[model samples]
Target: MDVRSSAVTIPAGNADLPADLLVPAEPVGVVLFAHGSGSSRHSPRNVAVAHALNEGGLGTVLVDLLTPDEDEVDSVTAELRFDIGLLAGRLAGIVDWLAAERPVGGAPIGLFGASTGAAAALVAAAQRPDLVHAVVSRGGRPDLAGAALGQVRAPTLLLVGDLDEEVIALNQQALGQLTAPAELRLIPGATHLFEEPGTLEQVAEAAAGWFHDHLHPQPARA
Candidate 1:
C-alpha cells in the first residue's frame, strides 16, 4: 500500500494537539491510537503498531491528547491522564473532525489504545457508536473507565501479557461488564510492554488481524 504521512495541529477546545496522520492509498479503514498514561504520540510501541496497521492497509491517526503546556502540568498533577471524561471528549472531537475531513468510504473506524488510554477509548467508542467500528486495548486499565465500560457497543479486543497477572485479571473483570462482543488474548512470556523478543511483533500481528477482520472490505470476485 502507498502510505502518506503528515502532521496536523487539531483544534481542541482552547488548545491545539499535534497529530500524526497516516493515510494509505487504498484504505481498508482507519484507526485512531490513544496513547497510555504518561505516553504521547511519540511512543515507540504505538508507532510500531500503527506501522503494522498501515501495512495492513489501514490509515492511522496518533494524536497527543494534551498540548505541550497541558502535558507539562499533567506530569506534576497526574490529573489529565486519569480524567477519562476529559480524555474521551478529546478523542471524540478528533474523530468528529476526521469524519468530516477524510474520505473514509464508510470503512470501519476503530480505537487502538494502551494502558489508561484504553479507558478513554472505551468511553469515546461508547459516546460515538455510529462512527467507531471496533476497539482494542493492550495492557489496558479498563477498570478505570468505570461505568463507561457498560456503554461500549463496538466489538472489543483486549490483549495482555501472560505474566502480567494483575492486568489480566482487570481485563477479565472489565470484559465481563462489557455489553459488546469482546475477547481477551494473553500473550505468554510477555510483560506489560511486550518487550521480550518477538512479543511486540505478536502483539502487532494480533492487532492487525483483529482490525483487518473487523474493518476490511470484502473483495469483489473477478
Candidate 2:
C-alpha cells in the first residue's frame, strides 16, 4: 500500500461499534464505506477499492452498519440487511465519532456504498449535508433511500452494470430524484457483481476521480 494504513476499532460515539479506519500519511480526504448488509469490512471488493483510494492519497473507513449480534439475526431474518434507516443511523454515528476523533487531521469526508448499503449512505449524507462532501455507489440500490433522495446536497455518482437491466433502471429513476448534482454510469458488459475482466478496476477509477474532484482537488498540472 502506498499509504501507511492500519486497522482501527473505533467505538462510535461511545457505542459498541467496531470500525476499520485507514488513514494515509497525507490524506486528500476520507471515504467512509457503507458496505452491503451481508458484507462487512472484510469484503474483498471494497478492500480493493479502498486500497486504490489510499494509493491516490485518500483515507478510508470500512465499517459494518450492523453489529455482530444484528448481523447474526439478519442472516436468518433478512430484515436488518435492508433496513436503510437503521443502517443510516449507524453510519451517522460513525461520522459523529470521526468528527471527534480527527485521526486524519479533519479532512473532508466522502461516502462509498454498495448494494443496499448505497441507500443508507445516501440517507446518511442527506441527514448530514454539511459533513459529507460527496457520494459514490457501486451496483447499488439507491432507490431504497426513498424521499431522502430529494434532500441530498452532496454530488452523487451511481454506477451500475450494463447487463443488470433492472438495477440500471432503478438507478436511472433514483438519479432523477436527486436535487443535487448526480450522474448514472454503466459499466459495460458487467453483471451485478461486476466480476467481469477489469470491471471492478473501472469502478475504482471512477470513484477515485469523483472523490478527488470533489473532496480532494489537485493543483493545476505543471
Candidate 3:
C-alpha cells in the first residue's frame, strides 16, 4: 500500500497546532489522535497505534492540542492539561478543519485518545454528533467528560489496563453513564501506559478493529 505522510498545521481557535498526517491509498476512514497532557504528536505509543491503523486502510492525524506558548505555560503550571473544556473545544475545531480540508476530506472520522485526552475526545464527539462516528479511549479519564458522557452519540470502546485498577473502576462508572453503544475491555498485565510487553500491541489491534468496524460505510438495507 502506498502511504503519504506529511506535517500539516491546523488552525484551531487562536492556535496553529502542528500535526502529522498519514493517508494510504483509498483509506476507509480517518482517525484523529488526541494525546495525553505533556505528550505531543510524537507520542511513541500513539504513533505506534497510528501506524497500525494506517496498515489497516485507515488514515490518521496526530495533532498537538496546544500551541508552543500554551505548552510552555502548561509545563510550568500543569493546569492547562486538566482543562477538559479547553481541550474539547480545540479538538472540535480540529474535527471541523479535517472535515473541510484535504487528502482525507469527507472521510468518516474517528477519535483515538489516551489519558486525559480521552475526556476531550468524548466531549468533542458530543459536540459533533454527525461527524464523529467512533471513539476509543486508552487508560483514559472519561469520567472527566462530566455530563457530556450522556450526549456522545458515537459508539465508544474503552481500553483499560487490568493492572490500572483505579482507572478501570473510573471507566466502569463512565461506561454506565454512556447511552451510546459502548464496551470496556481490559488489557492484561498492562499499566497506565500499556508499557508491558505486547500490551500496547493489543491496544493497537483492538483500536484498529473498532475503527474499521465503525467507520466503514454500511450496506443499504433493502
Best by TM-score: 3
| lDDT per residue as tens, model 3, 34-108 | 999789999999999999999999999999999899999999999999999999999999999988774585578
The candidate that achieves the highest lDDT relative to the unseen native structure:
3
Candidate 1 vs. true structure, TM-score: 0.94
The segments of candidate 1 whose C-alpha lies over 4 angstroms from its true place after superposition are 103-106, 216-222
Report the C-alpha lDDT of model 2 over 1-222, residue by residue, as the tens digit.
Answer: 456656676665435666777877878899999898689888999999998898888999987777788889989999998989888888887877776777777788899999999999999999989788899999999999999999999999999999999999999999999999999999998999999999999999999999998895323335
Query: What C-alpha lDDT values do all the predictions have?
Result: 0.88, 0.88, 0.94
Q: Where is the poorest 10-residue window by lDDT in model 1? A: 213-222
- Candidate 2: where is the Cα deviation over 4 Å? 216-222
Taking all chains together, each candidate's TM-score versus the true structure is: 0.94, 0.94, 0.96
Q: Quote the positional error of residue 84 for candidate 3 in Å.
A: 0.7
Question: Relative to the unseen true structure, what is the Cα RMSD of model 1?
Answer: 3.2
Weakest ten-residue segment in model 2 by summed lDDT: 213-222
**lDDT by residue (tens digit), candidate 1, 20-79:** 999888788899999999999999999999999899889999999998988999999999
